[model samples]
Target: MTITIDTTRCIGCGMCAYAAPQVFRVVGKYSTVISQPEGRRDPKVSNAENGCPVNAISVTR
Candidate 1:
């Protein structure tokens, strides 16, 4: 799986980082993916994507 965040849609809410610190971080006014998805399934990552108010997160496999 791969994770991507659309900066334009992001509100920098930090929920991604809160839900999956290993994969995301809030830098400045945007959420960033700190690492690539290493073919691992993470419930927290899924929760983060679902939790985005603007639906900025994307997961592809």
Candidate 2:
């Protein structure tokens, strides 16, 4: 699985980092995916994606 953050849609809220520090981080004014998930079904990654207020996070197989 792969996790990606759409910087254009991100508001730099830091929720992803807070929810999944191992997989995300706040860089500059955007949230970025910093690590790959253990798999497509990783709960941490999924929580981060769901936590994004702008829906900027994407998870793909």
Candidate 3:
């Protein structure tokens, strides 16, 4: 599975960064993808998805 970030929907709130710092982080005022990349097994991906208030993030297999 992989987590995708909809840049258009992202408001740059930085909430995703705070909830799952290991998988998500903030860069230049916008949320960014960290070390864990697409198709990589991750433990906190679900937490990151839930943290997004606008539902800007999701995981797919």
Question: Which candidate gets the maximum lDDT versus the true structure?
Answer: 1
1-61, model 1: which lDDT tens digit per residue?
9899999899999989999999999999999999986767789999998999999999987
Which is the winner by lDDT between candidate 1 and candidate 3? 1
Off by over 4 Å in 1: none
lDDT of 3 by residue, 1-61 (tens): 6677888788889887777787787777567787555665555677778778888887787
- Clash number for candidate 1: 0
lDDT of each: 0.92, 0.86, 0.76
Clashes of each: 0, 0, 0
**Candidate 3 regions off by >4 Å?**
37-43
Worst-scoring 10-residue span by lDDT in model 3: 35-44
lDDT of 1 at 11: 95
**Model 3 clashing residue pairs (backbone):** none
Per-residue lDDT of model 2, residues 26-57, tens digit only: 98999887878674487878888888889999
User: Ten-residue segment with the worst summed lDDT in candidate 2?
Assistant: 33-42
Q: Name the best candidate (by TM-score).
A: 1
Query: In model 2, which residue pairs have backbone atoms overlapping below 3 Å?
Result: none
> What TM-score, computed on C-alpha atoms, does each candidate reach?
0.92, 0.90, 0.73
How high a TM-score does candidate 3 get?
Answer: 0.73
